[model samples]
Target: MFAARPYEDVLMDDIAQQAGVSRALLYRHFPSKHALFAAVYQQAADRLLAETKLDPTDSLVGQLVQGMDIHLDYFVANRHAVLAANRVLAGDPVIQTIMTGELDALRARLLAVLPLADESARRTVSAVLKSWLVFVQILVVDWLTEQTCSRTELRDICVGAVLGALRPLLPADLVPNWPQLAAGRAGA
Candidate 1:
């Protein structure tokens, strides 16, 4: 119910009716409509993290592509919920924390896969990953609203973007042969 309809349109009474429970029982569990929305959004975030399987054998690019595909799939399917969470409840700390937690977990996975030279590199790459994740969130949320580009193009742009952001932070030796960079160099 929350995923399909705008958050403002989803009443506690309706949620209770859909769940085959009375308003009393629903309030006992969630307390309020905002609380209910938070629970649903948290479940979605947890499921996304679980589904984004990162194969250690795959290259960084491959892993990013896989992650983006999974996320994009969710975003497309739950556009209304995502928009409500991002726009309607933008000021909600609980909602923001869920978003941050998911992004931080993703950053840790990316840091694990990066070929960093030392603690300094790890820290630098972690910062870059943090910013890139936020960038993706904003861009993708905007895309959900306007759909200015194809889903595949959006995914590719996200993957390409993080790669571009990380290129400067990584060691010089690692940059030249990085998959997309290599392809780009050949063309240049």
Candidate 2:
């Protein structure tokens, strides 16, 4: 019931009535509406994170494409819930901390898969990856709102852009494969 209703509309009485429980009982579990809303946001974040799988064997570009696809899939499928969580967490310090930690963990996971030879290269790659991830997020949100293209088409464009940017940074073997991928994607 809470999930279906807007956070502001989910009064204790409404939840209690929906659950066939007294208001006091609901209060016993969650002290306030904000606490209950936070719990819902945390659960949603956890579920979304669990749904994202990273393949260790894939190249950095491949892994990024996979991650982007998963992210877009989640956003497309759960737009309302995600937008609700975004609104609730936007100004919440505790939620910001959690979000930062989650992003750091994801960065570390990607770093683990990337082949950085030197400290400078590692730092440079990390910065690029972080920026690229944010760019992808913004692009996805814009694409969603505009309905400018199919998700697969948007994904291809995003993937192509990132791969093009990373080409100079990658080894010869990887560099050659990118053009082929770009050509294949374009032809599709």
Candidate 3:
């Protein structure tokens, strides 16, 4: 329903009818449409986070590329659900909080792997990672909805965006292997 129409336009009666449940039953389970959307978003976010966990043994670039792959895969596989979630982003505080919290967890995981010299450097890297993640979400939504780019191309673009952000902050040794890492090899 979200893929076909905006969440605001999807009536609770329509949802209950589609689910073959009585309105009373639906309301019993979810007091409001916002509650239902929040439940859906939380489930999807938790699943994605679990599925895309970073490998501690992989190089930073490799881990990033793999994580991008996981995200793109999930988005593609659950296009309807993802689109629905995106449409409801403005309606509910609980849903927004769930989305933000998941993104923050992802940022923290990536920051842990990045090599930084001090608290200030870590802060800078974390900020860059968070900003790039927003870009990733937007781009992923666009790519999946528009079918403008191949999956591999989209993944490469995401990897490039992150690597570009980290270039000046990362060491020379760690900088050269980004492309290779995107191709499924670890950087030295």
TM-score per prediction, in order, is 0.90, 0.77, 0.83
Off by over 4 Å in 1: 171-188
- Each model's lDDT comes to 0.86, 0.69, 0.79
Write model 3 residue lDDT over 93-179, tens digit each, in one string. 786688799899999988877778999999898999899998988888888679898888788888888888888998877665556
Ranking by lDDT: 1, 3, 2
Q: For model 1, state the Cα shift of residue 154 in Å.
A: 0.6
The lDDT of model 1 is 0.86
Candidate achieving the largest TM-score:
1
Extract clashing residue pairs from model 3.
none
Angstrom error at residue 19, model 3: 5.6
RMSD of each: 3.3, 3.1, 3.4
- Tens digit per residue, CA lDDT, model 2, 1-188: 44555556567888888889999998999898767766766676677567666776766667767777887887777664455555645678766665566566667777777676888888877777677666775677667558899887778777777666667776766544665775676687
